[model samples]
Target chain A: MRAAMKDGARGASMTPRGIAAPVLGGWSAASEGVPANVRTISLQAVKIRMRSVGNIQKITKAMKMVAASRLKGAQTKCEKSRAMVNPFVRLLGDTPGAETEQTLVVPVSSDKGLCGGINTAVVKYSQVLNAMTPGVTYNVIGDKARAQLTRMMPQQINNVIVDTTKQPLTFATASAIADQVVARNAPKTHIVYNRFASAISFKPSVATLMSNEELEKAAEEGVNEFDSYEIEGPDRSEFLLDLSEFKAGVMMYNAMLENNTSELGSRMQSMENSSKNASEMLAKLTLLYNRTRQAAITTELIEIISGASSLESKE
Target chain B: MSRAMMRLARRVVGKNASVPVRGASTQSRASIETFMKNFEQHKTSPTMEHPATSSTFASTPVTEDVKGTPEKMKLNFYLPHDAPFDKTEVDMVLVPATTGDFGVLPGHVPTVSQLRPGVVSVHVSDKDVQRYFVSGGFCFVHADSTTDICAVEAVPVEQLDPEAVKKGLAEHQAKFANAKDDVEKAHAQIGIDCCNAMVSAIEGK
Candidate 1:
């Protein structure tokens, strides 16, 4: 019984090592590299890989910092501009109007690249809208969006606006587009762009431009409840018109800002992932190089010993 | 008095004594002594007479000509979103360009200048003494005397502590002291220079 107990304890202790050896052996095999000329060659390759990975890490870190800074500025601009548009939106609600003849769709995007699926997502949503409402024209802003739209819906895109990188998209730009849309006799306009949800996430948002109908509905729903006030004649009409245009412009601009921020963040995350993958690849390469070098050294040792023993036997 | 004069005359005649005035009269020497006594009295007085003394001068009247001067200037400062609006009248806006400081005043010819990280001094109007510091941005001065400052970042000298700026400078200096590369040194120097300028501006020297 005592012997049996001792045997059981020994088995228990050996079990972990028995289980661990196969895993370690498999890892070593997976890490093994092709046999090469010199041990230092493998070592040097690993060192180079490590250095490259280090460089990638540095670049990713820098990109992250830049994205963070842009995100901060974008958030502040979006919030403030959104607040300014609230009153204008209310004025739109107070206006009395009906559906007009034509509708225009303005799709906002970035002139640059690196935001993963941001441009693609906006373009897809625009296509869906276009399908829903046939004969709706597109005013494309940003080179990437233009390119995508031109490829997918060549006839749908009416005009393309070039790079807008100097400052945050403003009401002035929106007004210019709005004027063009109005010239085309389009009574309604819609803005499509990415809405920044957080530092890491953003979603595509669509806002109606020409209809105070939604705003009116919102007001009726007590969405913008305040103390009762009165508005009169041409003053009220003029105010509503100006307010609607301004509100539409501000909303579009805010969307652009959010989209810009999302672009930066998405690019940053993608770059970070790339950097991480590069590191993992480098680590695997380094392990392989080390194993190959060790295996070469062991084989050489065995060969040298065998030759010495053969020489000794001959002597 | 005559005996004192005689003793002076005898002392002047000593072997090491300089030559005495032969043509001049004794009356002139007495007059010189009297003048010396008056000069000493003047030196001992609490105040001296001068033409440009503030007390002796009259304050200049504020003229309507100065008031009606058609100087139209606009000043805008770049600050954080939540920063309180501290109303300060600016006369001249000094922006830090890549090359050096670019100063602009009323009726400054329209120009756009590239900006860098440095202290931007906006000399307050009326009071030639007060100055505000801006960190970085471009300044656009229009022909209409509208000065627009679009800065990446700005902070008032009054808001920043001198000691903290000094410490920041010290750290930057230490970082660049043993730097092996030009890029590292340049970046570190930029921080050091900015912090040093902030400290100097805060001290108001």
Candidate 2:
């Protein structure tokens, strides 16, 4: 009876161990063993993924560097041009002359892509402007601008100008646009673009391009009666004309510079965010892997102890 | 007429008889002649003493003496950060215009001139001049005598490093000398020559 009881106890324990061993071992093997093939495949997949991420990082880094360099140049140009235009505008404001009947708004945007949402935001602002003032016509500068305007308010677009790819946004191009506007009898031309605020911030800005009438008014106001002795010949008139064009050109050039800087800043910020997200994902995956590995090791240790105790008791 | 003459002769003869002698009459006549000469001298002296004529001639010296003091002129000047002078008394802003050199002084006619890349001289009130090198752009002088210059690019000549300019010129020259094509060589040569000239001008050589 004693032998049978001992045997029954041993059998019960053995049965429990037997049942638990396979289950625990199987779990351990499945979790920890991760079959060499599966491990190889997973590691290969990780490596591929890591390689892709690295490539993305490289591209982003390159882009960031390029944007940084370009941003510096563009910012300088933008700032200098802004300084040039402000005085001219102030001159216009101070001039006591006849106001024009029409105001033309020239919206500058990029023909290309990768500088995200800047083109879209500029277009949206234009739409808002159009809504505020009915019958307002637009002179679009880039392909993206033309595309956005065409889809939303095709009728509002009076002229679509294709960019001179060689020059891009330049004084010459601005002059051409100004000339066209002047010829069309547009009284005042305003430029709309994204002004760079920071690496992640770009605010839309609008600047006025002085018209001939404004120039004339400035000249008239600038000419004092006491000093009328200084006003000579077609020289004053010629100066006024050149001043108007130069002011307009500078305005356009500055807008382009601001837009370029803002675009690069946006891209840099976006890339930095991407890099941060990638690192976060990598950390999560590594934690998951460690947990699965630890769980497998604990199961194997428990199984080994249980097996050792059961065999020793049977002996 | 004969009766009157006879009366005159009789009066003369009675007067002659009443006279003491010819010598006494001669003495009276000599005295009369002396009195006539004195009268002529008094008339000329009185004319010379007239206050209106003499005062007009004497007033010219006072008027001429008052105008001898020189009038002084004042001018105000503002210099850029890169410029040598912090502040100067400027009489005018002289810019190198594309058409020609132009000047802006107080009470100048309102004008606008296209500026080219060159040196700008600012004439000061003290007759001293400050010079700046400006790049291409335009300048506007208001009737209020406020002159505003919009330069496409501007840098003080002093700010440019002479050594760097020389090095750049040499490099550009070498590049041109070794160019495989005429077009490339021409472009490089132009750049080299420009740098060379700029360096020389800035160094005052």
Choose the strongest candidate by DockQ. 2
Q: Summarize candidate 1's per-residue lDDT along A1-315 as a digit string, tens digits.
A: 334323323433443334334434544554585343344554564565456556655666676677777877777776544433322332222211113345577787888765578888777666655654546788887898898889887987788877776666665675565566545545556667777767678766655555444334433544332112222122323433543554455556666776787788787787667556655655665566667568767968998999999999999
lDDT of 2 at B21: 17
RMSD (Å) per prediction: 34.7, 37.6
TM-score of 2: 0.55
Q: In model 2 chain B, which range of ten residues has the least summed lDDT?
A: B50-59
Q: How do the predictions measure up, each by TM-score?
A: 0.48, 0.55
- Runs in model 2 with CA error above 4 Å? A1-51, A94-103, A111-117, A158-185, A197-202, A214-230, A233-239, A293-315, B1-89, B95-102, B107-120, B124-138, B143-145, B151-205
DockQ of each: 0.01, 0.03
Worst 10 residues of 1 chain B by lDDT: B49-58
Model 2, span A80-176: residue lDDT tens = 4444444454344311112345556677787665566888777765654454333468888878888878887776678877664336456666667
For residues B115-148, write the lDDT of model 2, one tens digit per residue. Answer: 7557777676556666666655666555445556
Fnat of each prediction, in sequence: 0.00, 0.08
| Interface C-alpha root-mean-square deviation, candidates in order | 38.0, 37.0
